[model samples]
Target: MRVAILGVGLIGGSVGLAARQRLGAFVTGHDPDPEAMRVGLDVGALDAAGTLAEAVADADVAVVGAPVGRIPEVVEAVLRHAGPDTIVTDVGSAKGAIVAAVDDRRFVGGHPLAGAETAGVRHAREDLFAGAPWYLTPRSGSSGVVFERLTRFLAGLGARPQAIEAATHDRLMASISHVPHVIANVLVAQAAVVLADDGTLPATGPSFRDATRVAGANTTMWTDIYLANRDALVDRLDDVVHRLQTVRADLVAGDAAAIAGWNDAARADREALLAVGLAGGTAPSCELRVAVPNRPGVVADVALALGHAGINIHDMTLSPSDDERTGEVALWVDADGASRAAELVAGLGLRVEGAP
Candidate 1:
């Protein structure tokens, strides 16, 4: 079980740590950056470090976690060193580019949808992929032994395996990942707080945190993700724009039903979606949507306040105000967290409600 990781950044670094958890798996990392390799070795994440040639030469499984665009080059670089029995896989966010370039014997594209807002080797955590879905895009009826070996490796790391087509993976990620990121990044960019005069951005509370958390993720990684999955993202982006236009029309026309329907669906998602991390618990206490002062460190202050009151917030999201003075925050913790959060914020000599 000697594993060779091509890039030891966030995803690759986490893979190394997770693999090390397995009793017999020996993980080795290969990164072009000398500092990255040094950190991997210093932390004992890799059994050894090597160049492009040495990393995959005798490796049992080659897990490529480089950027989506770099995946092709990384896979190709390692392929030259791959042995006949080696199982080659990748954890790139997008699949089409890598899948198309892979003409090797035992190539499989896998995306483990587990990561954080943070990146780099220091952010690597062993439980990063625990219970996360690892999408496997193996061509139909590939070597059974290769897949078995791959799945055995995944199971050892505590991930659930899902078999899907490469095209399907591309499309799903385009909508689920790229589209949301595009919207969030654009919204954050266009917001007025970004152009504030005092060099002070609007106070960003929880909703802002939820909405813009991924905004700070690797820009190059996201750029590669968008380009690799552009077609599907383009299609879905058009649909989303149309949907927003429809909603805008309804709002302008003062259509009650349309507004209610939108609110209802959003409420449903906010209350439900337990399959996800936040929204899946019991019925919510209050559909609490508030406009909080947009400023730095708003989310933590609010969370601390709620914690003091023993109020449990369920799910929350923030949309920073276009204007520097105000921001909107929506939280759906538990009843207690909500009450305490509000009370604590008020106690801090800050207004609990910015507008409503």
Candidate 2:
């Protein structure tokens, strides 16, 4: 397979490396940065580096790793130069705006929740996305062929790929990611003001250190992310402020019991959220093969059905019959969820082969 990587920075370089080393794909890379292009080729992340048009002209898949603010434009350019069958995806953190801007069947908006504090092509590693949840935000008009290709490619990179709505992805990211960055910055500012006049400031514990770890991260990227998801981030911030006010009220009222209960609730909530990611890690995975006819949205239909039913598809692939009139979609999911997942796929009016 020929893979084109636009913007050979950390994520793009990693994609090139994984595609070359893991998938044995001929990877061509494009980057405006001369140093990135040189290092990407030197580190074997890319077989070749050239102009944007030359990189994507004949690519089977083009992965755009441009900055969040430049993703839509980059994607547009890729589509203009790429083959009609070329599948395009992006690694921008914010998805809603980009998905809206690029209304093409071949474009699938994606965000891989994987990165390091260190940046640049020099720091890119082939295993950076291993085991990370790579979210795909497919449009209503997204081609199932392209979507399946992208998902399989991501899985090949050793990343867990899942489908999600663009709006939902943005909102959830605001709560889980964007807001935390804002809070971290706020914590640092608050701490800086507390010991402004004191020659020796109070020593900080691990809690403070941990909370402010991402206090001032990648200002250029974060600025674009904050503005892109402005409405959702603002909503979450308002909710946080309201909760803080309630805590203040409890302290003023001397409601010791309420304060303790609040702390306990926070602990339980954190555990519950973390458990979602930890669940079924060691569970045996079962494969269910479904016979599907050659169709545009067949793969997407079954994928979305299973996704909506909360069945996490660990892996998937499509095998076409000799005549190409029919195919089989083999899906792997946790053993515990296999029955329900098969039932969901069967409900889509397709025969779930090998289902008990």
Candidate 2 segments exceeding 4 Å error: 291-298, 308-310, 319-327, 346-356
lDDT of each residue in 72-170, candidate 1, tens digit only: 988887887889888899998788777777876577778988888787887788888776767776654354345546766776677755556677777
Model 2 lDDT per residue over 275-302, tens place: 8777733578889999998877778777
Model 1: worst 10 consecutive residues (lDDT sum): 275-284
How well does each candidate superpose onto the true structure, as a TM-score? Answer: 0.73, 0.93
Show the colliding residue pairs in model 2. Answer: none
Task: Identify the leading candidate in terms of lDDT.
Answer: 2
Q: Each prediction's Cα lDDT score? A: 0.72, 0.88
Candidate 1 CA-lDDT value: 0.72
Root-mean-square deviation of every model: 18.9, 2.1
